[model samples]
Target: MSATSVSSDRVDHLWKGVRAGVPIFVASAPFAVLFGAMAVENGLTVAQAVLMSAAVYGGASQMVGIELFGQHVAPWLIVFSIFAVNFRHVLYSAAIGQHVPHWSPLRKAVAFFFLVDPVFAESERRVENGKRITIIWYAGMALPMYCSWILMTWIGAEFGSQVMPDAHAIGLDFLLSIYFLGLVMGFRKRPRWLPVVLVSAVVSVIAYRTIGSPWHVSIGALAGILLAAALPPRAALPLEAAAVEEATS
Candidate 1:
């Protein structure tokens, strides 16, 4: 391709990623705002609140951290709690790393920083569909989401209660679960995913009731990983067989 054409393609990919992230951004707005408000309410300054959103972009962990901080929990315990909540990022990084094995160290570092759930889900979906993902494309998805989160967080810190007096009453908390469910459903056709999902759900409930807090997430994820490892890999369908199956569907 000509240089101009290649540049155009890159821009197109970036824009496509941005478009893919829009729904996630919308879904996350209320939660981001809530976090900011809660952070300030719990004794964080507006600067500290926005800084947390900017520096630590993991929403769940940020919420947990702010809550723990509010309780005057030991700093080490707060850090450990945040780490436990976000340990799943290690798996996400491992899975996506294969797609960019040739990336420079700097590029890899930047990519890891942006490797949040929505970006990972979108990028993984594209990869599964056999599309080539560029760094710019990934950034397109990540940067916008990051900006929206921080912006919403600041707004929440500054004016959350006035604007959203009852964020819970509006059911904002359930949006994340619904959003994640939609992402999970996208992989329903993958033979191994359903079993893992079911197993993870069961384990999560048991762990939540017993171990509680972040342990449930870690236990559930480990259970899913172990189950996936033990199961035989599903064989790929032959081209003709796949065509026939597609036609029947």
Candidate 2:
């Protein structure tokens, strides 16, 4: 393709990613708001809470961080906790890297920073369909979600006490669980996904009750990874397998 055509295609894909990410952003908003509210309740100032949201951009890890901060945990331990919670990103990067081998180091670094669950999902879907994935497309999906998270965090910090005095009573806290459930449902048809998920959940609950906090997340993820690695590789689905399977049913 000519330079102009390539640029246009990139822009088109970028918007496509943005559109795909909108629903995820909506689904995540409640959690983001709750994170902010909880951060403030844990003694974080509005600025500190918002800054955490902007810098970390991982809702689960940030919430853990806030809890640790409130407990006066050692700074290094807090860092480790956040790292453990976010270690799954390493796997996410590895999976997406296959499609962008020639990306510049700077582009790769920026992309990795924004590589959240929704962005990774959309990118993986595109790659599975043999579509070209571009940095612009990934950024398009990431930036808007990032902005929404930060904005909601600020709102929650500023008004949570008054507006959401009883967030739990209103079920705001359950939104993240529902959102994650929806994500997991999407992969239900994939081979071996069930066993992996079940193992992860069982291990995670045990770890949470015994070891506690960030360790549970890391342990659960590692358990899933190890189980997956031990399993024999499944055959790749044919490009039209989804359509064929759907039509038969």
Candidate 3:
């Protein structure tokens, strides 16, 4: 392709990515604002609240950190808690890493930096549709959400000083749980899903009763992950069998 056409294609790809990412960013905006409000409510300055949104980026980790900070917990413990909450990103990267083998080390690093939950979902959706994840496109999608998150954080910090009273109390913090549950349900048709979900839920309940709050969360997720990994994938049958299955369906 000519130089002009290449540049045009890059711009086209970027704009397409931005368009695709709009709904995700819009959906996540409330959580971004809430995080900012909580950060300031927990004694962080407005600048600090915005900075945390820009730097940390993980909603769960940021909330856990701010909550721990408010409780006067030790700094190391706070760091550990945040790490525990974000540990799943390691799995996310592992699962998707092979799709971008051609991405350079620096490109991979930059891409991973923007790999939040919604971003991961969109990327995986593209892969399922057999689309390639170009660098410019990834930037276009990620930047809008990333920038809006910081902006919303500032808005929350500036306005939440008085109104931050019952936001958390009214159960806004549970929004993430509902959002994630919906995502998990989206995969209910996948193979062996029932076993994995049942095992995970049972383990999580047991852990919640025994190990307690935060730890139970991770433990239950881990149990499901382990069960999924251990379960053998369904094998493809022969042509005759496949034909019969398709006929029945």
Candidate 4:
């Protein structure tokens, strides 16, 4: 294809990725609204709310940050905690490193800012055909998600708590467990993650109840990493093969 035709085709392919992201946006919207409301109620300013959405762009990590913020944790510690919670992004960078080899330094930096767990999960799950993925597709996904986050945060900062009465009694806490369980189940079709789930959950609950810190998430993630790393390569290879098959097929 001519260069112009190739560029156009790439744009079209990216639009498809954005369209595929719609369902995820639907899943994320309510949670973003909830986080916005909670952040504001916990005393974050509208600017802070929107900034975290724009800067952090991490739903779970933002929630954890706000929880720590509310607990009167030092700002530096809060920053460190957020970093620890999101450290897994480094692994994601390594995984996709070869795919986007020609990306400029500035482009790489911009892409990292918008990276979040769901974006990582979905993109990794559905990489396209022989055509190398372009930066435009990643940006397309970030654009809407970023807008929704800040818009929802602004709305909630201004009005969410007033409207969302007795939300605590409704037990949305269960949703966190449910959501994590769903993710685990999604990965559990393979055997390796079955142990990862069991060990991670057990480690998480113990850490949460004992060495309580907003940073407990880092501990749990480390537990999974350590356990997964320690698994016999022979035993883990089958699960890895299944995951690859699922991703490719």
Candidate 5:
């Protein structure tokens, strides 16, 4: 192929990623605004709220931090709470690492900064369909979401409550959860998906009932990760051997 053709391919892939990421950003945009408003309400300046969104880029953890900050909680507990809420990113990085072996250390560092749930899901879906995870494509998807999040945060800090009056009264809080459910269901066809989902759901509920909010989310996810790692599909050699042994026994 000519250099011109290669350039065209890169732009095309980048555009494809941008298109793929729009829906995610659209779904998440409201929550960004909500965080900004809530952050301001919780005593953070508009700049601080936007900075946190830009730097941390993790919505759940950001909210947890904001709430803790509002309560004048100790700095250590607030940091620990954010870490607990974001522990799933550790699992996400581990899962996606195999697909990006060609990436340089710096590239991986930059790319992983935008590794939210939607990005991780969409990347896995792209890989499952046999496409390589190109930098152009990843940035195309990531930039819109990342930039829009900060933009929305500013808007919310400046005009969120004034515009919406009562965001929760209108049920904006449920939108992200609904969007998350869609992401989870997108992987339903993967091997052992349902079992992992069920186990995670059950464990999450149990943890919520006993241990409480943020911990339940992380603990539930950890349970699912453990199950997925320990119990491969029956087609795998170790699983096949176990099946054979059980059958003979």
Candidate 6:
């Protein structure tokens, strides 16, 4: 596509992505409620829980933050651990950077603040050519999700203890797994990408044993990148075609 065509398509795609992603944000409600319940279980005050949702705005990081805080890990370690867990966002930023390259540093930083795993995965899939997807689409996904998270967190912190006799047993934590699976099943249509997922899991296990908590995510990211580099597919479409062929054959 011509540069102009690509830019225009990107904007169009961004608009569509925003519209499509709005439902995902709405679908995130139950999970946000679960996060709030988890926050309360972790002994966060309602204010702290809500603020963490607003400030961190990253589900996995907030979960990890609560876990670290509950363990009484040093505050500096908690900060570094959450940062390490979230560092993969740097890669996400790089992927979508072209779409918004001309945006100022302040604007970029603001966009980065709302960057989370789901929005990153969704936006990356929708981007084309070298054009950057507009940050507004990301905001469209993040802002409402953010509000839902904070409000639900406040409610959970206030009332969850009174209601759920065993919140963990109720399986609220599974929402995290389900959310991840949704992202993976969406983008990982290629057989080659399957190996990256496996390698990432293996690396995470190894890192969990050797490096422990926060550093494991860093190792997993490195392993994932290496795996992707090693097993580059011909194209995403070819992978889909291969799957169809296999199923028919």
Reference-based TM-score, model 3: 0.73
Candidate 6 off by > 4 Å: 1-18, 129-132, 135-138, 168-249
lDDT of model 4 at position 27: 70
- Superior by lDDT: candidate 2 or candidate 4: 2
Worst 10-residue lDDT window for candidate 1 reads: 240-249
Q: lDDT (CA) for every model shown? A: 0.78, 0.79, 0.77, 0.70, 0.81, 0.68
| Tens-digit per-residue lDDT, 206-249, candidate 4 | 89899886545668878987988888765444432453433333
Residue pairs clashing, model 2 = none
RMSD each, Å: 6.5, 5.4, 6.6, 4.0, 7.5, 7.7
lDDT per residue, candidate 3, 1-249, as tens digits? Answer: 899999999999899899878988898788788887878878899999898888889887898788777878668878888887677577556655777898998889888988887787677677778888888888888889999989988988888656666666876567657755765675565557789889888998999899876566568877888887788757734433332222122
Candidate number with greatest lDDT: 5
Worst 10 residues of 4 by lDDT: 240-249
Candidate 5 C-alpha error for residue 234, in Å: 13
Q: lDDT tens string, model 2, 1-249? A: 799998898889888878877987897798888888889988999999999989999977887788788878678988888887676577677777777987998889888888876777777777778877777777777889999999999999999878876767977656557755765676567667888999999999999999986567669978987998899978856534432322222
Instruction: Identify the runs in model 1 with alpha carbons over 4 angstroms from their true place.
Output: 164-249
Return the candidate ranking by lDDT, descending. 5, 2, 1, 3, 4, 6
| TM per prediction | 0.70, 0.71, 0.73, 0.75, 0.71, 0.63
Clashing pairs in 6: 99-131, 99-132
TM-score rank order: 4, 3, 2, 5, 1, 6
The list of candidate 4 runs beyond 4 A from truth reads 1-14, 121-126, 172-174, 180-225, 235-249
Worst 10 residues of 5 by lDDT: 240-249
Question: On residues 1-249, what C-alpha lDDT tens digit does candidate 6 reach at each position?
Answer: 799998886687556656757765776666666677778787788788888888887776787788777778679978977786676566666655655777789988887776665666555555533434666556665666667767877877777777777656876656567755665565465456678888888999999999887567668867987777777456545432333322222
Q: Candidate 2 regions off by >4 Å?
A: 1-7, 167-249
lDDT tens digits, residue span 66-112, model 1: 87777786688788878876775776677778788778889989889
